[model samples]
Target: MRPLAPSFAALACLALFSAPALAHFQEVIPSADVLPEGGEVNIDMVFTHPFEGGPVMEMKKPVKMGVFKAGTTTDLLPRIKQSEIDGKTTWSLETELVEPGASIFYVEPQPYWEPAEGKYIIHYAKVVVDNYASGEGWDELVGLPVEIQPLTRPTGLWAGNVFSGVVLKEGNPVPFAEIEVEFINDASITAPNDAFITQVIKADANGTFTYAMPRAGWWGFAALVEGDEPMSSPEGKDVPVELGALMWVKTTDMSGK
Candidate 1:
């Protein structure tokens, strides 16, 4: 179904609307696994928020992995997109990190496809049922995983333009390495990362910045090239991320300025 490069036309008018495909994501899956026997567990799929006041998480599908074997039937493998930026709406699947031993992972599903409820909450979330259910890992007495719930459907945030910045290298200021911005809200920042607040801005002094998310639904933003220092996670898996995954931007006329 590859027919969208007419320059994308504002993501093909938000993919021919009618609504029913909301999403928000964040699934790292390691849950303290120390499987030394056949040793092979290193899932790294991140996109977190709740206001990444010290951020760094950029996603564009390529973190493929879905191995649910034992009798076989769940091996949705696909990964390898490399890089993406400039009027976004990406997905290039064909991944397989191959480690089909003690499996149970279904990573990769959130890039326009919602229907959990309606109204947009976190960017794109889907992974409940104990996160994937298996042995409960590292011995918590086994019985903990499925609890990924937050998809109040009704998406279509940036019907036209979006892009925000702050990622330097030779000029400094590269905190968390991922600045894909373009918001429009005009000095009213407060939607830290319910993932779809649309626009919110701040950053200056050669670091550069911009914002204008005056009202849109699905949105995107990620930063933290390890600059501006601040990072944490390890308190109960430290889950408090609001924004999930809504990265797509660059469509002009932003309504008026």
Candidate 2:
């Protein structure tokens, strides 16, 4: 007979070590959700496991970066500056908010090769910033290949309020879309386990989903969908691409009350 199989403890350790990592979020986080009078906007652009807050993956220069406002789109890629997070390449930008309305900033990052998943990932991530207290244009569609159209206002939200949106693919609603919600773990909140690291939600027949944020911080919602076309990987194998439509929102606390 062959040698005895590994013991239960040995197998358990092997399985645990071989488990895949958590989901990756393409983050487009503005320093603030609401720009006070005479305030400017600064943004952090990164790809990482938001809730775990580390081992940030490298992000190449974005393919597209722009702001949509008042029926016009302006290219903002020129303002981006190279940076690093946790020894991984990242990017940042700062822009002055001259107009007194909501500006939607979005980015299309270059295809990232994820070796563990054996696929390329491209997330079209965006965020809304209300300037000078003007609440207009927060819901405007920037016309990305994939995106989340907010049914609820994306800004000026309070903690514990429900955030809702419809997942759209090429301007049409995607039924039963899968969304993963994660918060930037800046406050040292620990998850009980891997399952609680990222909260998963699914859209209904009309592609609408909602979640009540329990904390005051920046939250990232990613709508994941399979790409129609496949891309060739470095190993010369054709692999599926994971296209993500991601959005970021911030919630405030009621401490002053």
Leading candidate by lDDT: 2
* Residue lDDT tens for model 1, 1-257: 97756667776777667442322334333322223333334443444332232122355563344544444445444442333323332333232323323333445443322223322122322221222223232111111121111121111124443334443443345333333333323344565554443233444564545545444322344332321222233332312222222222222234532
Q: Give a tens-digit lDDT track for model 2, residues 1-257.
A: 89999999999989977885789999999888888784778989999998988669999999999899998999999989999877889999998989799999999999999987889999999999999878788889999999999999988889899999999999999999999999999847988878898899999999999999999899999999999999999989999999999999999987832
Instruction: Flag regions of model 2 displaced more than 4 Å.
Output: 1-3, 7-20
Model 1 lDDT on a 0 to 1 scale? 0.34
Clash list (residue pairs), candidate 2: none
In order, the Cα lDDT scores of the candidates are: 0.34, 0.92
Give the TM-score of each candidate: 0.22, 0.94
Count residue pairs with overlapping backbones in model 2.
0
